[model samples]
Target chain A: MRPSATWRGLLRPGDYIVLAASIALCIAAGFGLWRGGTPDGLIIRAGGEIFAETDLSRARRIAVPGPLGTTLIEIQPGRARVAADPGPRQYCVRQGWLSRAGAVAICAPNQVSLILTGRGSDFDSLGY
Target chain B: MTHSVIELTPTDTDRRIARHAAAAIALTVAEAAIPLPLPGLKPGLANIITLVVLARWGWREAAWVSLLRVFAASLLLGQFLAPGFFLSLGGALASLAVLAGAMRLPSRWFGPVSHSLFAAFAHIGAQLLIARLWLTPHDGVFYLAPILGGAAVVFGLVNGFAAAALLREKAHAG
Candidate 1:
């Protein structure tokens, strides 16, 4: 059967409802997947294994030993940073403070890495 | 020595399905040539053919055209039996399943646009599920949900309009 409506008058009431619902679902997915909260703790890894996981509620210093030397991590309330590293470039130390969820500081030469974790902070993979 | 020859006869319905599947396959191969800014993001131009077929024929014919397009197009693109082939198959199957149910909606209200939107979303949703389960095997794949969802809405509407236009033209001509 030939369609009763043309392209000009194609959108029916159901069409409008579907369109609205699609756009709404898209918006909801964007917000739900992309939005992240502040990080609550920091995880330190050395030699490809988890070395330490601590909350950012108290100020503390963690020294994780790796192949090269000790990598010092300084944690302040709600934030953390790499204080020192034996890695040549000091890339992790230069990364400064990591406060947001999913943030990372990697000392490749020293084989140490720090990652901030919180609700909705999960990441599939991290690249250099 | 004597050789026996076998002959095959295809009925009218078979020819019609072949014709529609050929069109869908052509569009699929053509669409693959277009450069995409992001991985897994496609304009889904072939979906237009599926929507058109569904509107002109029925869900079974549309399913045949869509699945045939996936298989034939993959073979033509030299991606047969590859990971990309499975992705294409998954998306086609998901979308065809959705269209089957969507086709039952009241014609006075729902039409090509609604069916297209539903199929597009289902297509991407299934692809993402497959990628997470088999390919990436990580929850991080969900991070792409927003971008893909948005693409589905946009492309779904565009393809839907294209199908509507084709139906209109055919309606006038026939």
Candidate 2:
């Protein structure tokens, strides 16, 4: 039979729901595992007082995150300089190197956050 | 089915060409509905429709519909000649490759249903590889992996059923 260049009707509502749900599930799964709960990329920390400051020209962005609060930061070019201030727990230094999605490292009490946001703009183009 | 006005043309050849183009357009619209933050990679549902056309018609006709759909849609959607446009063009080309491979199979080796799924997998794999390498500027690629893979399986099954029904209907009518 010759191919009928027909306009098949719209997908039934139920079918649309099914396909959409599948898509959402896929996106969620990827983000949850790949970038969920990680913080190595460029992150913002909450500080009542000056805790530390780092130059932005050193970090390299290596990955893309799909969700909230996830990054992978590799500090090699320059170390983030820490400053003495008031907060509580100065655990900021204790937070180790970050390189995976969906993981976070923070300093409690001081309220300083150190996250890895996939591609650090500092060295994005430079980091192949 | 409610085909486009082109199908109502008086000329036979034109009608046939119009019908094929109409289907291609319809499939492209369906593909557009599946949204993602990033462009290029999709479940390749449009390709399944193209493959079905190839199976029902000839490869030449199918190729015409496929290219028209890609070029026309890219222009209409305003992705004309952009990087995403190239990705879609590459996807259409790769899909044709899969369709050719499937058509070469023995008649009884697998039904149209299975063929749709197979072609879908191939299309998704190629698009994924492209996205991982090109489109994704950051960790965003990670988010697309599961979605693309899962969409391939789910939509593949839906398209498979549709293809099988189409083939079965043709057989009975003949």
Q: Top model by TM-score, which number?
A: 1
Question: How far in Å is the alpha carbon of B26 misplaced in model 1?
Answer: 1.0
TM-score of decoy 1? 0.76
Distance from true location, Cα of A61 in model 2, Å: 34
RMSD of each: 5.8, 13.4
Shift of residue B142 alpha carbon in model 2, Å = 5.1
Q: lDDT tens digits, residues A43-106, model 2? A: 4455444333343346443321212322333454433322332334544434454444323455
Tens-place lDDT per residue, model 1, B70-127, is 8999999999999888988999999998888999999889989899999999989999
For the predicted complex of model 2, DockQ is 0.12
lDDT of 2 by residue, B51-71 (tens): 567778867777787888888
Over 4 Å off, model 1? A1-8, A41-97, A102-116, A122-128, B1-5
- Considering the two chains of model 1, state its CAPRI-style docking category: medium
* TM-score of structure candidate 2: 0.53
For model 1, the TM-score of its B chain against the native B chain is 0.95
Docking class of 2: incorrect
Q: How far in Å is the alpha carbon of A119 misplaced in model 2?
A: 16
Q: Which parts of model 2 are misplaced by more than 4 Å?
A: A1-128, B1-15, B30-45, B137-143
Name the top DockQ candidate.
Answer: 1
